[model samples]
Target: MPHLVILYTSQLDGETDMSALCRHLADTMLTLRDEAGKAVFPTGGVRVLAYPAAHGATTDGSGDHAFCYLNLRMARGRSADVHRRTGEALVAAARAHFAPLLAGRAIGLTLQVDEGAEVFDGKFGNLHPLFTPP
Candidate 1:
């Protein structure tokens, strides 16, 4: 499973479309593949979530300063190269998505990929079954 969480300043709610960005990121994630050309992330297990921070400060808290941080968490079975590719792809997609805003406002965009030991994982949902081959 690949989960992408996007946190951005609330002011952006009036400037751009967060829902569109989420779909863009999710679509980008679906394009990832391993070196052997196998799909990297299962379509059913991919999720993109975005939250607007009601309060935030960037740099000196001056001059239309805004920020967006994207965190991608995945299972710990992928190779280092795959992890690297995932991060790079997400960042590239985000930058492209925010181009219009970045040109008009001082926005900081950051993306990171995290893969840590899962002490306990419990998943309950019917979404996965919808993507299974008949």
Candidate 2:
């Protein structure tokens, strides 16, 4: 399972479409596949969400700056290379999404991939069946 959380300053709300950006991210992740060309991430397990920070300040408490932080949380089982590739793909997508805003102002963009605990408890629906063929 992979869950993406995007946190951006409210200042960029006018310039950036958070909802669209989230969708783009989700779509990008779905494209990732292993060496064999099999999908690495399940379609049903992909989740993208965005949050606008009402009050945030950059270094030196400068309100003029804007920031976007993307965090991808997933179960721990993939290799370092996989993680790196995923992060790169995500950052590239994000950069493209915010290219316009980047040209106009100082926007700090960062991506982080977090590996969850090895063992955890969870529940799910029959969504996986949709991805599986008979």
Candidate 3:
């Protein structure tokens, strides 16, 4: 399971298009491949979500300093190289997406990929079927 979650400051909500960013990230994830050339992240299992933080504080609390934090949670098994490439790709995508806005405002972007041990895992959905080849 791979879920990319984006948490952004509300200050950037007016200039940021969360929907577009979500699509951009999901599309980027689809392009990642493992050592075997197979998709690193399954298309059907991909999930991207963005949330605007209404109340939060960033470093050097100044005037409307915006921040976007991206966290990708994926299953553990991939090689370190694969994870590095994936993280770099995702971060690059985010930077490109916010380039124009970055020029006009002060924004901080942080990204990290986590593969934590889960005691219990459960998934129920029909979306996976839609991505399967007929």
Candidate 4:
């Protein structure tokens, strides 16, 4: 399972091409790795998802609003605060990276995180450390 998953969609326009979006996403992933390196999550482990706009969706009819979503998964043993922080980081990354492309356009971004039970030694199943004492 990936620690981070970033999903982004933008209006297909002259300014916002798929290649540019991909590059931006890649840069964001690098930034994420750098940030994670300073923290507990494994570095260079962030995974991003690419979701193209719905079929036949056009920038003219759709009003050129980009939708970005990010999802993160982490060990359940950690506190909810950690997950919250991760979500914030993901949001910040989107805002910082896509701000230029989203300029003068309606853009929406969301973040969701799932916390799973911690697996230790591969023999024991997920034991939510937050709920159960070690």
- After superposing candidate 2 on the true structure, give the runs of residues whose Cα lies further than 4 Å from its correct spot: none
Clashes in model 3: which pairs?
none
- Candidate order by TM-score, decreasing, is 1, 3, 2, 4
TM-score of 3: 0.95
Distance (Å) between predicted and true CA of 94, model 2? 0.4
lDDT of 1 by residue, 17-126 (tens): 99999999999999999999989999999999999998877898558888889999999999999999988998888888889988877888889899988999999989
User: Taking the candidates one at a time, how many backbone clashes does each contain?
Assistant: 0, 0, 0, 0
How big is the positional error of residue 26 in model 3, measured in Å on the Cα after superposition? 0.4
- TM-score (C-alpha, index-matched) for candidate 4: 0.56
Off by over 4 Å in 3: none
- Estimate every model's Cα lDDT from 0 to 1: 0.90, 0.88, 0.91, 0.55
Residue 70 error, candidate 4, Å? 1.5
lDDT-based ranking, best first? 3, 1, 2, 4
Instruction: Find the number of clashing residue pairs for candidate 4.
Output: 0
lDDT of 4 by residue, 55-123 (tens): 444346646556666666655555556556556666666667667766776766677878766655253
